[model samples]
Target: MLVDLHSHTIFSDGRSTHAEMVEAAIAKGIGIYGIADHLCFHDNPWTTRLDQFEEMRSTFANLKANTTSAKILFGMEVDYVRGCENRVLRLKEENHWDYIIGSVHYIGDWNIDSNAADWEGKDVDATYTKYLELLEEMVDTKLYNIVAHLDLPKKYGHFTDIDFTDRYRAIGEKILANNMAFEMNTAGRIKICNEFYPRRDIVELYHQLGVDVTLGSDAHHRNNVGQFFDEAVALLKEVGYSRICYFEEGQKRYLPL
Candidate 1:
């Protein structure tokens, strides 16, 4: 059984529509799929109002109420902005979703994950330190079920000399403490880093910490719905993961791999 729980559509930065995403998931033989679109506070120059949130809720509710396609769930890939947890929480509270994916995309109203120029003239070490700190804080918020793209700081291939073991260990501990799962988001395979979201060592650490595991493609287009999923599954197996998790009606369930 194929499980892909992270994807986007025209709702956010994705390139496909909701119908297109469903068709692509069915085409890929995915038994379980999730439409986890972006939900953030920092405008990034784009703002989603309460009304828009309700509209998104209607789409999710309608999909659940009316879809005859493969098993699908509605979720939001919410960004964790430092010092704005309460505001972000309020924004997310407007909707009753199947699940929530907490991610750290900003450090202080600054988008550091994508666009090479974002890293230009920036201190990679300080940025990474703050990113990890915010990641730990985001998990501490305990407002989300899963953490998306664990190594987002590396999304644009920014690496510093700082040791990641302590930082990742702390982050992993927090995720475990909060009962949040992190997925092997394969979208990184297409990024400059050209690796999974977290890379292998971090996955290994999570397994050692007994953290729950899930999977995603972070697909923005229909064709990429289940892109590189097989590789992610194999990588999980190699890392000692025996089952993958999914959500249904806001409840977490696992399927043996």
Candidate 2:
């Protein structure tokens, strides 16, 4: 059975409604489907509002109650921006979400969705360094169940010249120290990079560091629900990973891969 832990719905920037996303997962025979809409500061356009959260929660509850074959889990993909601890804590305290995926979608003064031409040419090493700094902060805050797409700056195409081994080792150490699971996100294959997020080298390094791993599609549409999931499982098995992590009531649990 396959489990996809990172997905979005119309509550954020995704194209599909929550029910459509869930139904598609069921059709694909996915064992567990987690809905993780974007969560960011109120000023961000993609930030999921409280009403949207309630609507998604209602949808998940109904699906869980009515569906016997598949399990639908409610989660959020929160951007780890500066000064986000209180919001993270509040969301966890107030909601009965199954998991939270913390990601660094913005740097010191740059956002991932920016279209400025020069942004693409920025130094890959420096950008990754800054991203790692933010990742360390995310781990220190202890506000999430998993770290989504550990090496996201590679999506910008500037990291082709950079060697990520040492850097990934450092980041993997921090993740292990915090007992946080690192996600092998397949969304990159369909999105900007046309490759798996974090790539293979990073995944092997994480395995070497003894860091637990999780698989996520980061799916924004119904067709992409389980994109590259079988390949992801194969890669995990190759790296000696026997299980993937899941979240229940804010705690992490291992499930057979």
Candidate 3:
């Protein structure tokens, strides 16, 4: 069963409408497909506006009722900002989403993945450390079901000389403690990094830590729905993961890979 829990539509930065993305997912044989568009408190070009929630909820309701080929989920990739907990919580409460994916794309107003210029002559190690620290804090909030793109700092192919094995393990521990899962986002393969999010070694460490995982394409275009899913499943199996997880009515569920 192919369960892709992360995708986008015109609601965010995606290139297609919700209907188009769902049709593509059906064609791709996705068993359970989720459309998790970007949801951030801060105003941004790629995030869905707070005012559009009601319309999106209604649209999802209609899609769930009409779509029969695959199980369509109403999800949101919510950004984890330090002072935006209440806003996120309120959104979750009002929407009653099937799942909420928490992600950290900004570090003190610096959009880490925006461009390589953000890393100019700065302390790469400190930035990496800060990202992990924020990741841990996001998990600690216990407000999210899955963490999107575990190692986002590598999106621009940036690497830190300092070893972060312990840090990765610590994040895994926190996810386990909070009963949250991290997604093996495949979008990274097309990014400058040319690798999957949460590198192979990190996946192996998570497996060792007994942390759960889910699959996400992070697709912004209709054609990319369930993109690279076969490779992702193969990698998970190689890392000793026999099953992958998803959520239903805000409850976590699993399916064999």
lDDT of 3 by residue, 1-257 (tens): 79999999998999999999999999998989999999976778999998888999999999999998999999999999997889888889999899999999999888888778878876778889999999888988899999989889888888888889998898899988988899999999999999999899999999999999999999999888888988999999999999999999888899988
What number of clashing residue pairs does each candidate have, in the order they appear? Answer: 1, 0, 0
Which portions of model 1 miss their true places by more than 4 Å?
45-49
Cα lDDT for residue 80, model 1? 79
Write the number of the candidate with greater lDDT, choosing between 1 and 3. 3
Against the true structure, candidate 3 reaches a TM-score of: 0.97
Task: Name the lDDT value of residue 116 in candidate 2.
Answer: 40
TM-score for each candidate, following the candidate numbering: 0.94, 0.92, 0.97
Displacement of the residue 67 alpha carbon in candidate 1, Å: 2.7
Identify the runs in model 2 with alpha carbons over 4 angstroms from their true place. 114-121
* Candidate achieving higher TM-score, 1 or 3: 3
Per-residue CA lDDT of model 2 for 109-189, tens digit only, reads 577544546475577668787888898788778778889988787675556566657867877888788777888899888
Index of the highest-lDDT prediction: 3
Q: What 10-residue stretch in candidate 1 is worst by lDDT?
A: 43-52
Residue 131 local lDDT, model 2: 87
* Candidate with the greatest TM-score versus the true structure: 3
